[model samples]
Target: MRIPTLNHILPALAIFVSGAAFAGDLKIDVSVPADRQGLVMAAVFDKADGFPRGTPLRTATAKPVQGKATLQFTDLPKGDYAVTAFLDENSNTRLDANLFGIPTELYGFSRNARNMAGPPPFAEAAFRMEDNAQQQAFELK
Candidate 1:
């Protein structure tokens, strides 16, 4: 085999370093009531527009064990992010609300931010993901 040249090695190294510089992982821990059933869904948001309601940059799900569920997001770009989590007890792929538009199911947001009228604003829930790994916790209301 031929020895690798400077041009070949430099370009490969640059690509690897650049790709790694902007990526990170996030681990989430969700606490739910022991009586609760079904899977826990978590979503990641990258921008304030649309926020906790609009489409998410990524989503993850896991079943709770011992009243806690753990989920992880890998290879996310290093940037500001917000998270929303819900316990989908009915497995309907949606949060259930009562006739008054008040949520009947358990749900929460990053930083545990809450608003009396509705979901918290993106700014209230946003967190910086600057390191290679980060963690967030949520307790469903």
Candidate 2:
């Protein structure tokens, strides 16, 4: 008898499966510019809904260095997730905005998907993560 690795099973079962998904923290390390540095609040959303609200959620914040920061998400349910973060120089948890709700600070989303006119759609931000554990590194633009 042989035991199959998760890599083989995951695809066979589909990209996602009910009652089976990775749980726990997914560590992310980000390398960013020194000119824009501050506390980075990462919003980890399962979908567009329940965002900036409700209790079922995942979030992480990093104390920025001049050039880099490491973020660790705790107890994140394995599934589709989008990570959006901003350089909060003002120590505010919310995005700093201009007159028209346009952001004044450096911001980013997963996959680095940017919209021509505004924010990317939720589908664009979505990334499928496996259960158990994972680690990733992203270089900010």
Candidate 3:
């Protein structure tokens, strides 16, 4: 309701708008051992990280070589997040496993947290995006 007050709010608005400019574009380097097929897909989460459940904020697919891949999440909000991926050897869109419960597809998570019985919690995989541009390297377990 104050006209001159707009001047005082301009700086805050600039910072807010600047943050949106780099919302996504979260660059992530993934290093994982692909299955025999050499196909891999990385899922990156923004606010909610998939662990113990593997819920992804966003997912990107790539063909890995030498057990390594570079994945990126465009338009990701600057916040706490995590990432994961699987070999997708069968390309079934889901990680397959044998009767023994061993993953048929090579799979991994951020922070390389491996649970013997189940997936890790989001809190365990969570990391902060301190800058407008963020980068991280996640190794597949």
Candidate 4:
């Protein structure tokens, strides 16, 4: 057989690479407290370092309907991920904090993980995303 040209082989390689990147969808169901009503923000982290701090691999926002909100991150490769979400009752993009640096707004973590001293460690909040669609729920605290 004759060797294929670079242009012909490149296109096939690109399609194969991109197909692997489009893995699955992550659905997050957030339960907001009845007392709070506003925008719901969520972040998806793929690593432990800078988690719940720096920019996440994906972000989603939605308005709570009757104290519940659903967010989805599509086309995420199969891997480990953690989620952090909060209710922005004041319409601010960032989570509001009190004078003591404690969060004033309602927040939640993946697997409903929490700590008495502070936020839960990344390991406590991590979940695996496999070949199929994955779903996780969190109740605001």
Residues 1-141 of candidate 4: C-alpha lDDT, one tens digit per residue: 989999999999999998787668999999997777889999999999988887899899999888889999998987889999999888869999999989999999999999899888889999988876889999888
What is the per-residue lDDT of model 3 for residues 1-141, given as tens digits with 9 covering 90 to 100? 757588789999998997675655677777875445656787766655234355666778887777677777776666778777777767688878789878876777777767777666666777777676777777765
Looking at model 3, report the run of 10 residues with the lowest lDDT sum: 45-54
Clashing pairs in 1: none
TM-score, model 4 to reference: 0.91
Per-candidate TM-scores read 0.89, 0.72, 0.73, 0.91
Ordering by TM-score:
4, 1, 3, 2
Write one digit per residue (lDDT tens) for candidate 2, span 4-81: 999899887775663355476777776678887678777777877754333325677887676877888866666787
Ranking by lDDT: 1, 4, 2, 3
For candidate 1, lDDT tens digit of each residue in 43-131?
Answer: 99999998888999999999999999999999888899999999999999999999999998899998898998999999999999998
Number of clashing residue pairs, candidate 4: 0
* CA lDDT scores, all candidates in order: 0.92, 0.72, 0.71, 0.91
- Index of the highest-lDDT prediction: 1
Give candidates' CA RMSD values in order.
2.3, 8.0, 4.4, 1.8
Candidate 2 lDDT for residue 27:
77
Which model is ahead, 1 or 2, in terms of lDDT?
Answer: 1
